[model samples]
Target chain A: MKLLAITSCPNGIAHTYMAAESLRKAAEALGVEIKVETQGSIGVENEFTPEEIEQADGIIIAADKAVDKSRFTGKKLIVTGVQDGIHKAPELIKRFESGDVDAYQGDGKSINEVKQERKQKQNPFYRHLMNGVSYMIPFVAVGGLLIALSLAIGGHPTDSGLQIPKDSVWKQIMDVGSAGFTFMVPILAGFIAMSIADRPGLAPGMIGGYIAANGSFYGSEAGAGFLGGILAGFVAGYIAKWIKTWKVPSVIQPIMPILVIPLLASILVASLFIFIVGAPIASLMDWLTAFLNGMQGASSIILALILGAMISFDMGGPVNKVAFLFGASMIGQGNVHIMGAIAAAIAVPPLGMGLATLLNKRKYEKAEQEAGKAALAMGLVGITEGAIPFAAKDPLRVIPSIMAGSMVASTIAMLGNVGNNVPHGGPIVAVLGAISHPLMYFIGIIAGVIVTALVVNLFKKNVA
Target chain B: MKLTELMDKSLVDIDLNGSSKNEVLDEMIEKLDQSGALKSKRKFRKTIEKREKEGSTGIGFKVAIPHGKSKAVTSPKVAFGLSRTGVDWNSVDGEPARLVFMIAVPEESAGNEHLKILQMLSIKLMDEQFRTELLQVQTVDEAYELLDQIG
Candidate 1:
């Protein structure tokens, strides 16, 4: 009895394969003939055939994300989430074999339709939040890399620490990098609200985020930063969603979205920031800046240790972003050493994971080996988030290994006077001349990477 | 396509104690041979083994439908037997099969006739009422009557 299955997940990484493996094993154990297809971040694998479908007993779809099911029409089908596929595969197969499943009627709405419907039903606030995150990531990568590049090329040793020559081309490159940094908050808030309320939310979310990022409007020196942008996005999104849901006359419905929703939501969101959330957040940002600026000796090392842990912990998550912003602010203050340590710490996880995969191919799967290659390239450019997929899957082993390595690297950078003129890490930045004691900087990074690789390899059990 | 056309009272075995796959297959073949349904045991066994070599026919859920189309058959027929202890059929789910349905169709009508019988069985198998009754039947006539009702 031929059977077909599809497995997928939100992240399209570990859970996808895990569910696929479970279904395959369960089918084999149940004495059922079956073929499984997996849809992952890398795309489709082991696809099904029309002939197989025609001869099949039934089809099983286990996915969190969308999967096309129109092909299974006229065949007995069991539709469920990926977790069900993993845990209840045998039972699902039994139900199929027992002929209990209904014939699949192709509704023209495949798995993609189901996913779109689910997305539409999600809280508009969350939709906006993800939108902001998605748009913000590329900007962060570009800004961080350019600054790292300018520092490596134009930076010189100075009493103020590593300093870029005022009139140099590299200095202009640094300015361009900071220019990208400037849009980080506004773009984040704009896209988030756009995701929620469509075109209308864009204006309000961006304006609110801009106001939140600039301290002058809120009567505080330090801006609320990305945190404020997130707040603005949620505020704008919900206000827009509420307005969209409200009953209006047919004549005014179209106008409501075009004018009323945007106007009302934007005003509400912007006002809330100016009157309520903005002052406290600005003060907090200022206090954080002051605390970091005043730190010295052991106190500074303690701060560095905390920063290193946070940066390595989630591999570009909120904690990592906070640490990153701290280092970035230091770059603006013309104190490059703290940023230098941050840069080194940032590259440790991805570089370490990549090194670990290369050092022991047998320890990782085929897909993981491929990811390691990508991670290595991203690590060289100081994109710590490249390691997020690995860390998300096996955080128990990957996170601690990365944290230890980053902490050690940060400490070494502090001790050896490896200062960064730019707010980035990785050997490429150092090679470009962004760092002081470039040799020691390389040593620190290499040492951290080696330690992380070794530690992760030691802890990770062979999956196969 | 009628269930009675595929199921025979003489082909149904009431006593099956085999615990191994080979033993169960042999017992089923012996009953089919005794009923004069299969002409060559050796050829029919070879056909089933060959089909298994290509891929397991055990479609999961503790059910093994080992089928073959060969000249060994006197007519298209299906034999039913229950092995409570279960027999390893190298099934897709890797579970030992408890219910065995062996179909032996003539080679000439193998394609259409075998598929029709399979479709009929597949549809009825989904009915809990049919399966529960079939499982509880202690006599060959009772099984054949249930098959007859499916038509």
Candidate 2:
């Protein structure tokens, strides 16, 4: 039997040559013909020609470092570390003679890389939603902060809420902020479509989103909000991507992506929103607003409980996004209390995790203690993902502890009638003066953080 | 330039007293340091120990090549040692290592001539006849003359 072997080591020093020699000596003793390749400090030596590889019955790669196996496609193969080549040369050669080896097709990836690919390949829907939300956040932050600035510097409190004078520069700043808000829905939809169907889907999705957000197209008073923008994005993206699959003549192919796909997708999506989808979505938005506005003490507490649970459940995943989106949309509808409750809940997870490490240093490792310091800074600025390291390590104990704390905070904020005008959360919002009843908000956050720290420490055993 | 240029008679130890891996490493480093190839033996030893921890340089068949590329090396050098009583080097073949080579290269020493010579020496050591001949050497001059042919 004819076999080929390749051996390599990271430093390209001794192991490579040693392994090659061992394999060669073993093959000769077994009366098997073999050609050995060594990748050493001086580079490749005695490499196999294409014909030699073709004539071989099997190939063995014993490498401590990566060696390209692409040329060995369709050959029976065994791969292992260089140490194995030195020690198990006889056993490895006997495998081919034993007739159990399979031909290699050349594609090999590390286990971690394969797992990552599987995760990305399976959840395009969630990936698309996350893409849209990520693009939409910068607009939300800029618009919300600028409006808050205008209200703080140029406005007095009325029975309705804070309002800026129409002729002032603060008003122009607020107007610029408002203009940023106007693009929010369109940008969300446009990017979502782009993620799904590439650049051709952008124009169609944005146009569809604009129509979805305007009630006049469907003869209604209140427009459809983020929910409508999401629907518009999916519809436009799928339509454009579907159109791409249809075969066209060679003459029309050049214009397909740039002109044809976007044009047709835009028309179909806009018409669908105008003629059929818009009214129902607008009415749905109205129904939602009215329901939230009409909630009594018990109902409002239930809402707070649900929002708090969701915000801490996934810690910035889809469940958290749903709760955040609900609160953010209410800001445009003149109800800031929902967001105030949400803001209190959002800061609890990271703050609680940070506090837990401080309360009991023995429960965490050295790296975690350092991460705790960073988490505290993140919590102050309202980033829920700051708690991810803790939650990832001890999900059952950490998640439940944070959830309970967030529920308490949300309930406190809701009961105290705290109001936040911006679409953000945490002590930073309170410090920025965008929050009403700032004292109550601070109390809620502190209470939640303490609760989380105590509960998590109670569940954890001291690290040995 | 050949491996004989990097390794002289002073660097050869026909009789090594070390009975353990750590002792063997110290003895080898002492030889290289005495030859004035290493600026800081401690720093170079750390680099060699770090590489050993990744995976032992014991390539089985009673042979071990412990090497380090470091800023502490004053020049490229090779030290050879033979422990009549083999030292445990965590070899894949589960045999104690008797034949030892310690290669020290400066971090930025990119000379290819001596590097090719070292490569030839590594490959030549794998030959059973060559190893048996090395085992028969009774003095440093005999080992140095044997290694001198491979340039």
lDDT values of the candidates?
Answer: 0.72, 0.80
Of the candidates shown, which would achieve the greatest TM-score relative to the real structure? 1
Candidate 1, residues A358-442, lDDT tens digits: the string is: 9998877676776677677668867675565466346567889999999988877877777887666677667666788877777
Worst 10 residues of 2 chain A by lDDT: A109-118
Instruction: For model 1, state the Cα shift of residue A171 in Å.
Output: 5.0
Q: How many steric overlaps are in each model, in order?
A: 27, 0
- Reported per model, the fraction of native interface contacts reproduced equals 0.00, 0.48
Superposition error at A376 for model 1 (Å)? 7.6
TM-score, candidate 2, chain B alone? 0.96
Q: Candidate 2: TM of chain A?
A: 0.51
* DockQ, every prediction: 0.01, 0.17
Each candidate: RMSD to true structure?
Answer: 20.3, 20.1
The residue-by-residue lDDT of candidate 2 on A1-464, one tens digit each, is: 99999999888877787788789889999999999998877678897776687799999999989887767777899999998887799999999999878988667654344434445445677567656756765565455456545755776543334456788999999888677667767887888788888888999988887876666778755345555677788899999988877656534765888899999999999899888976665565456545544553447889998788878976654357567777887787888989899999998988898899998999886767766775676677676756755664566688899999999999899999999987777787787688999989999999999999999999987654
Native-referenced Cα lDDT, model 1: 0.72
